[model samples]
Target: MKKNRFLIILTISVGLFLLSFSLSYQLITNKSEDNKIAKIENNKLENDDKNVEIIKEEEKVSPNTIIEQRILYKECGDLIVTNQTPSTDIINMTKEKYENYLTNKKPFLRVISFSSNKIVTWGEKEHLCNKHFIIGEEDGKIAVFKIGEDGERLLHKIFVDYPVELLMELDRDEIKKGIRVDSEEELSDVLENFIS
Candidate 1:
C-alpha cells in the first residue's frame, strides 16, 4: 500500500514540474518577441524623422524649383541631344499645347516621350537622311545628297534629269553655294516644284 502511495506522489510532482517549465519557456519567448516589435517601431520612427529633415532642406535650397531638361530628337537612325532651360513662354504653356509648340519649331519632329531630364522625339525618315539634304546637279541630273553627321556629303540618289535651265532657276550662288533642305519631305517638295 505504501509503495503505491509513493508512486502517486511522484507522478503528481512530475506533472507540476512540467507545467511550471512550460509556463517559464512561454514567458521567455513572449518577452523576446515583444523586444523585436519595439525595435522595429523605433527604426521606422528614425527613418520618418530623416525623411522630414530632407524635405526641410529641399525647401530651404529652392523654394521655387527651376526645372532643366535635355531634348533628345531622333529620326532616320540619328539622334540629337541638347540641354535647355525652358523659357517663360514654354513654362506658361499648357500641357496639351506643349508638344504643339515643340513640333512647330521643328515640324519634322514629333514628340515620343516627355520624361525626367529629357524630351524624346522622332521625325520623318529618308534613306541616308541625316536631317540635312543637299540638292545639286550631278552627272547631268538633279541629284539628292545627305550631309552626314561627320559633315561628309554622301550621295543619296538622282531625282530627275535637267539641263542648265534648272540650275539657272535657282539663286546664281545657290548652284555654287549648295542648297540645303531641312527634311526628306521638303526635298521631294522642292523637286516637285522644279519639275512643274
Candidate 2:
C-alpha cells in the first residue's frame, strides 16, 4: 500500500509539470503575435507621415500663380487692348473713350475691364504690383511704359501705386522725388543690364 501511494503521487506531479509547460508555450506564442501586430501599426504610422509630406509639396504654389488668378477674378481694365477688331464704325469712338479714360491725375501700370462694364485699376502699391506681376522694373531714375489691352500676354512690371478710382494719382510722391536724370552713359548702362 505504501508503494502504490508513492507511485500515484509521482504520476500526479508529472502531469502537473506537463500542464505548466504547455501554459508557458501558449503565453510565448501570444506574445509573439502581439509583437507582429505592433510592427504593423508602426508601418502604418510611417506611411501616414509620407502621405503628409507629399501633400505639403503639392500645397507650395508660386507667387505668379496667385497673381494671375487674382487678375482673372479682379476687374482689371488697365490691360485692355485699345484696338479691338469688329468695330470698324466705332473705331474712332473707342479711341476717344480711351483718351478720355486716361485723363487721370496719376500714372497707370495696367487697366482691366470689369466684366464689360468699366475698367479696374492696378499697381497702387510700389512693390505690390511688381511682387505680384513681375513685369518691369523702375528705370533707376523713372519707370515708364505705354500700355494697351492686348499686351497682357507679355510679362511686364506692374505699377501698383496708382489710384483705384483714377490711374493718374500716385500713392506717394517720393517715387518721383527719387528720380535722377540719367546721363547718356548711365542710360546705356541701364539698357545693357536689361538687354542681357
Candidate 3:
C-alpha cells in the first residue's frame, strides 16, 4: 500500500511539471514573436516617414504651373498709377487728360517709385545707382526706368519682356546661379538671352 501511494504521487508530480514547462515554453515563444512583429512595424513606420520626406522634397524641386497674380503700382512724383484705377474719376479720365498728364513733365523732382505685392527681385541692386525706378509695361513691352534723385535726369530706360513663365523660370535660374543684374543694361542683356 505504501509503495503504490508513493508511485501515484510521483506520477502526478511529473505530469504537473511537464504541463507547466510546456505552457511556459509556449508563452516565451509567443512573446518573442510579438516583439519581432513590433520591431517590424516600427521599421515600416520609419521607412514611411523617410518616403514622405523624399516626396515632399521632390514636390519642392518640381516646376509648379500655378500662375500667381500680383498688383504693381508705379509712382511718379505725386501721382500713383496701377493697371486698375483706384477711383472712378481716374477711370473716367478723358484721353486728352491722360495725354496731358503724360506730356506735361512736372518741374518738381521726378522721383519714380514702384510698389508691388510681388517681391522685388532686382530693386536693391538698382537702388544703388538710382534713388527711384519704375517697372511696368509700356507700348506692350515690359520696361524699367531709372529716375535721378534730382528728378531731372532719366538715367536708364530698359525694355525687357518674355513669356511670363519664361520670365519666372529665368528668375529662378538666376537665383540658382547667384546672378544679379545691377544695371539696366545687364537686365536688357539677360532678357534678350532668355528671349532668344
- Winner by TM-score: 1
Among all windows of 10 consecutive residues in model 1, the one with the lowest summed lDDT is 56-65
Estimate the TM-score of every prediction: 0.33, 0.27, 0.28
The per-model lDDT (C-alpha) reads: 0.62, 0.40, 0.45
By lDDT, highest first, what's the ranking? 1, 3, 2
Give the worst 10-residue stretch by lDDT in candidate 3: 117-126
Q: For residues 1-196, could you state the per-residue lDDT of candidate 2 as single tens digits?
A: 9999999999999999999999999999999999999999999999998888443222211222211112221222222222222223222233235434445532443444322223333433222121122113353322433223332323233334532233123512433332222244554464344343
Which has the better lDDT: candidate 1, or candidate 2? 1
Most accurate candidate by lDDT: 1
Give the Cα-based TM-score of candidate 3 against the true structure. Answer: 0.28
Model 2, runs deviating above 4 Å: 53-196
lDDT of 2: 0.40
Q: Global lDDT for candidate 3? A: 0.45
Q: How many angstroms is residue 8 displaced in model 3 relative to the true structure, after the best TM-score fit?
A: 1.1
Clashing pairs in 3: 110-151
What CA RMSD would you report for each candidate? 11.6, 20.3, 22.1
Model 1 Cα lDDT, one tens digit per residue, 1-196: 9999999999999999999999999999999999999999999999899888443311111222233332233333554544455665665444346568866775656656553344445554343346688886666666678877446678888755554355565543464455778887888887776555
Clashes of 2: 27
